[model samples]
Target: MNGENAYLATLMELFGRANFETRRPRTPEAFRLDPIRRLLEGWGNPHRRYAVVHIAGTKGKGSTAAMAEAILRAAGYRTGLYTSPHLHTMRERIRIGGELISPSTVVELFGRLRPAIEADPDLTVFDILTAMGFLAFAEAGVEIAVVEVGLGGRLDSTNVVSPAVCLITALSMDHTEILGPTLAHIAFEKAGILKPGVPAVTAPQTEEAMAVLRQVATERGVPLWTLEGWRYGPEEVAPSGQRGKIQAPDGASWSIRLPLLGRHQWENAALAVAAAIRLREQGWIIPDEAVREGLERVRWPGRFEILREEPPLVLDGAHNDASAARLAETAAEVFPGRRWGVIFGVSADKDPMAILAPLRPLVERIWLTRSRHPRAADPQRLAEAAQALGLPGRIRSEVAYALEEALAEDIPVLVTGSLFVVAEAREAWAAWGRMPMPEVDPIPVRVGGR
Candidate 1:
């Protein structure tokens, strides 16, 4: 096995033996910050040692955090990035400079953290992972860390950091059970990361959500910069999916060429750039070249990622309504006038109709499939949902089968709506080691803003 694969195998075994989720899942309601605080205190408060940028939102937090990290790294900062819901391996959650933490490092950290885990057995899976990331980043001497909230920002384990800048990406309905049912409530939860006097950068949000964020920032005496005011025009779009740009914030302009795709990504890149400028204003030497270079070098997987070309296979993890809307918009721009064969799966908790409704018009045929996760929606149920929209589609039991059917249609195939589905598709594609016909190259675009 390759090094990464071998490391992943060992980490999974450790997680299983640790009974990582069994102890905390479906627990009594406790959104109090005390638990995580105590846990980090036990680890000697490693999170406090490094400067941090805390990113929170319903969607795009991971991509935004990643863009910020890449930009910081381009400016010669030793950056640490922490994100959840790993595509293939758990190690993908914690990284320094785009590489997963080493197997020895994982083993050592687990060894150090074992006593704490055994003592409180009630700590959640996310809590342990957050602690691991803090410890790992601290040990690696990371100059700055980009931390993505695991769930709602208010109670997420990563909330320990008093960030340099709190970045809230576009908020939408997601994790409603934990974050609250309404968009405003969810936005309030995300805005919990705002520390006193810490500047915040936000993407476009509903009036209600934006109001909550603005209120929170005001209460905390922090400045809140909205992305709508920072507009960027698409300078150029490469067939490989790169989009060049110029951002206008407060009548001041900065040129950037984002390596990621989609117009939504342009907004994301703008957010990242805005945040970087904020950091610079705070006396961090983030040059304009670093802003442009960092954006061009940013790598965020599974956001409109094209895994193969011939017959064009694309994958996007747009599991929520807002993200689905963005994915639909991107599809319209990238594959204009082309009807795509879509292979889709989503978690049972999501509003599948919200996802299916947007892509319905652009899709030629929809192949519904179940992702490997237990929470995956039943393919039959998903087909029913698609039919509810009066869209014609096929249903298959497994993702591989759905892919096969979509490939047989001899049209561009897009696998999306769930990260789990994308992960499974990537695993299958890698295992086969054979390129599909009409190979589509991944055009990386810049995602997330300052």
Candidate 2:
């Protein structure tokens, strides 16, 4: 195979293994960390070599992790960031100093990991990717890594780390099949990252979720910090970004500007600020200015991302009802009085009505579509679902084709539902506008284990 093909083949080999991200676990027991733990043991546990900030939540966890990594990086600390469900490339899951892990490095790391991978027939694709992230961080001499839990906290592969700080963003009902049926059950799973004596900070949560987290923290002897005394509010919200201010517990306040939009992101920023303060208390040398700069300059694409200006095109990865609600609110707030032509798609496992209901009032018409993801819901099914919700839409099998049709409308356009859909829309926009592509076309979406 040629060099590009070689890299693609290597990635395919890894994705061909059991993957829970593309497929739901059969039961909660199916998510055990034993295989990953044993696999890491064989590699000498590179994750233990660096300090970590572990975060888990139904929403905003990725944004919180990205903000924390940016803050640490701005403080001159070599940082590694590991997130999940990559928008474009598998390499986006692992980053050092805000750069994606190169394809060659992924190939090299997979080659190094192959022997152990072969020995353990039970390892999932996420398990292998988690191993690659830890090994890459160790190899790159990362001082601290911000790790976002791929799924629930307790059995997640990333939970292997004993983090310097744990952060749980605002919790809501999500992954009800895997985590549980209620908010408290979901909170219990998210609180699984809480280690004894490891201080954790949380965003504002429902009383049910907060109570569970407190019980878990008290049982684990983890000192948990809530955003009780902290204060934050958005000063301005615009298409480009938003300006916000936060008043931390210690009475120190910061005026911040964030590239990521939405009122929820302001909350995520406050949570990051709280986590950074906890890190400072641990003597990490993060200054006030670093926090501000990191919060301001942090680049988390695909979350309320404005991909174009005139006749606005917004892209967001709001798959769940709570996040979709936020996306709807933000979209309406930012582009007031403009009826939107929305291109919507989502995973089969998600509730389409719960997602579409939030956007109904804001939407004039929908271009129902499916991403290339194996788990993506059928567009024809989505069209029928949208009809039930009193919304009108036509079906499109491809995201680019859907976008082409949606943009032809004179109103604002929104491409959302799943990160996978947004990723495809992003690439289509880039291609149509002759913008630079990534090192490779997004890793092939024909993944297995579904």
lDDT of each: 0.77, 0.88
Over 1-450, each residue of candidate 1 has an lDDT whose tens digit, in order, gives: 765465454455445432322222343255455666777899789998988999998777888888899889989999999997777656678999777886667667876887777777556556777888899999889989999987778777788798999899888887776678899889888988999989889988889999999998899899888876666756676547655665565686667666677887777777888889889888899888888888878888788887765667888999887788888887777667768888988877777888888888788888888776656778888888888988767888878778877777789999998887887777667656754422211211111110
Please list the residue runs of candidate 1 whose C-alpha ends up more than 4 Å from where it truly belongs after superposition: 1-28, 250-252, 435-450
Candidate with best lDDT? 2
Cα distance off (Å), candidate 2, residue 52: 0.3
- Number of backbone-clashing residue pairs for each candidate, in the order shown: 27, 0
Residue range 1-450, candidate 2, lDDT tens digits: 666887888977888888787877768999889999998998899999999999999899999999999999989999999998776777888999999988889889999899999999999998999999999999999999999998889999999998999999989887889889999999999999999999999999998999999999999999999999888878898888888799977789999888888988888988998888888888889899999999988998889888777789889988888998999899888888888899999888888898888888988888999988879898888898899998878888899998998887666899888888888888898888646764444465833211
Write down the RMSD of candidate 2 (Cα, Å): 1.6
